[model samples]
Target: MFKFTLKRFGYMLLTLFIASSITFMLIHAMPGDPLAVAARKLPEQIKANYYAKYGLNKPLLTQYGLFVKNAVKGDLGQSLASPGRDITETIMKHAPISARIGGQGLILGVTIGILLGIVAAFKRGKWPDYLVMFIAIVGISVPSFVVASLLQFFFTVKLTWLPTTGWGEFKHTILPTIALSLSPIATYARYMRANCLDVIGQDYIITAKAKGVSNVSLVFKHVIRNAILPAITLLGPQVAGIFTGSFVVESIFSIPGLGQYFVSAITDRDYTMIMGQSIFVSALFIVALFLVDIIYGLVDPRIRVSSGKR
Candidate 1:
């Protein structure tokens, strides 16, 4: 287990490095200057001073090196769009909002999804199963942005049951949370249903049933325990995706989250903001995957053994 964990940690570091490097190169390669729009009316001397201050006048390789060095020291530099605003500070201020919404969405979605799947599997071929499957299909097919729009129209505009947009009270979060959760709900339901069906059909399950094991005991002790493993594998990536916030969802709902800033940064050519956000999200995703790998080993020791051997 120790060896497996160490190996995964090393891989995480390597992946983060590669991701940051790619982000830096790609942002630099993009057309238009980060300061061009804002500084266009300035004198040549002032423009030169501005470029020098931000190290935009430096060569790409030098800037990349400085970025890596500063990032290592926990300094992500300033936002080009909002001059003098520290990128790291911006993240610190906004990340909690995104986390709150994402966390609620993930918990609500996964819990409902797992329950729906279990019911469907237990009532295979019945109306319950059909209904669950139908919900899953529709949820999966519809994009979160579209879901957000419909939710806004129905709940806020038409029904007046929820606020249209903003971030303050609990009511503000409900619509966005639901929008974010639908796809995850759909995803987990399918995975859980499939895994549950497979587990139910196993010879061990059949033998236990033949011995007249209580349905509740059989499900808790045998069915869910074994069936939930695959879902655990999916949890890491799902958490990363949701926790980082959805670009379109944040935009549509006008939530002040890191995702919203990220979108605007792209259009405004805020190089540091873009790089900072990309690195932060990539690191989060890598760390989540690392934790999942460790969890996978703990849940199934055979995985640790196999991984260690390799």
Candidate 2:
């Protein structure tokens, strides 16, 4: 297990390095300079000074090396869009909002999805099963942005139950959370249902039933524990995906989160902000994948035993 964890950590670091390099190269390759974007009307000399000030005048490779060095030292540099603000501090300020919404959505979606899946599996071919499947299909089919728009219109504009947009207050979180969670809920439900159905057919399940195990105990203890393992595998990557994807949701709702800044960073050609966010998100995703691997070993003793033998 220790060796496995160490190997995964090394892979995570390597992945982050490759991701950062690609992002840096790609951003530099794009048309339109950050200086031009940041200071459109400034005189050429002033722009040149700004370029020198931010080390934008340096060679691309030199800039990249500096970026990597500074990043290693926990300095992500300043935002081109905001001028004086540190990219790390900016990310810190906005990440919590995204985290709050994403966290709530994940928990809500997973809980409801697991419950629905259990019911559907237990009552396979019945009305409850059909209903759950139907909902799952709709949830999967509908795009999150469309869901957000409809939710905003009906709940905020027409019904006036929730605010139209903006962060702050519990009411503001509901629409966005529901919108973000819909697809995940559908995905988890489908996977869990399939896993549960497969588990039900396994020899141990039948043996437990034949041994006169109570229905509830049999389902919860034996069935859910084994069945939910696959779903657990999805949770880590899903967490990173949720936070990254929340940009669109945040934009629609006018929420003050990293997503909003991420979008602006692209359009404004804020190179530092873009690179910083890219590295941060990439690191987050890689770490999540690493943690997921560790979690797999923890949840399934088979993996640990297999690793040990190897």
Candidate 3:
């Protein structure tokens, strides 16, 4: 287990390095003078001074070196978009909001998806199964931004049940969370339903049922416990996707989260802020995957054998 963990960590570092490198190269490759793109608020003399101060006049290698050096020291440099706040500070401020929103969405998504799947599987060919599948198909078809906008229009504007934008209160979180959760819930439901069907049909399940085990206990113990493992196995990637992909939902809802900042940084050509966010996101995604791999080993015995060989 320890050896496997070490190997996974190594892979994580490699993944982060690749992601960071891509972020660096892509930002540098964009057409335009970064400082000019950042906007020339100062006079020519002041601009020259700014260039001299920040070494903006230097070659791309020198700038990349400086950026990497500061990054290694946990200094994300200044945010051109936000003059007073540093890039790291801005990201830190925004991360928790995204995290909270994503966390709630993940829980809601997983729970609803799993329940709907279970019901569908239990009923097999009944109307309940068909209805749930139809809903899942609709969810999978709709884009998140469209869903978010429609939700805001109907739930917020027409009904006034929830806020259209901002993260001011509990109600404000509802629309965004639902929007973020919709696709994942639909996907997970399909996966869970399939797994549940297989487990129920297994010989072990028949034995348990023949022995007169209680229905609730049998579902929980023999059926779901075994069946849901596959669904649980996919959870790590799904969670990572949730937090990272919430950018669209956050933007649509006007939520002040890291996703919003990340998008803004790219659009504004705020290299430092963009790089910092990229690094943070890469690191977070790797860590989530690492933790998930470890959990997979703990829960699924087959993974242990494969991991050992690797």
Instruction: Evaluate all candidate structures by whole-model CA lDDT and list the values in order.
Output: 0.89, 0.89, 0.83
What is candidate 3's CA lDDT for residue 151? 90
- Say which prediction, candidate 1 or candidate 2, comes out ahead on TM-score: 1
| Predicted model with the maximum TM-score | 1
Global lDDT of model 2: 0.89
Tell me the lDDT of model 3 at 276: 86
* lDDT of model 2 at position 182: 87
Candidate 1 — which pairs collide? none
In the range 7-98, model 2's lDDT, one tens digit per residue, is 77898889889999999999999987777656778898898898887998999999999999999998999988788999999888888999
The TM-score values for the models, in the order shown, are 0.95, 0.94, 0.89
Which RMSD values do the candidates have, in order?
Answer: 1.5, 1.8, 2.4
Off by over 4 Å in 1: 243-245
Clashing pairs in 3: none
State the lDDT of candidate 1 residue by residue for 131-208, as single tens digits. 999999999899988999999999988999998989899999999989989988888888899999999999999999
Supply candidate 2's per-residue lDDT for 70. Answer: 96
Candidate 1 vs candidate 3: the lDDT winner is: 1
RMSD of 1: 1.5
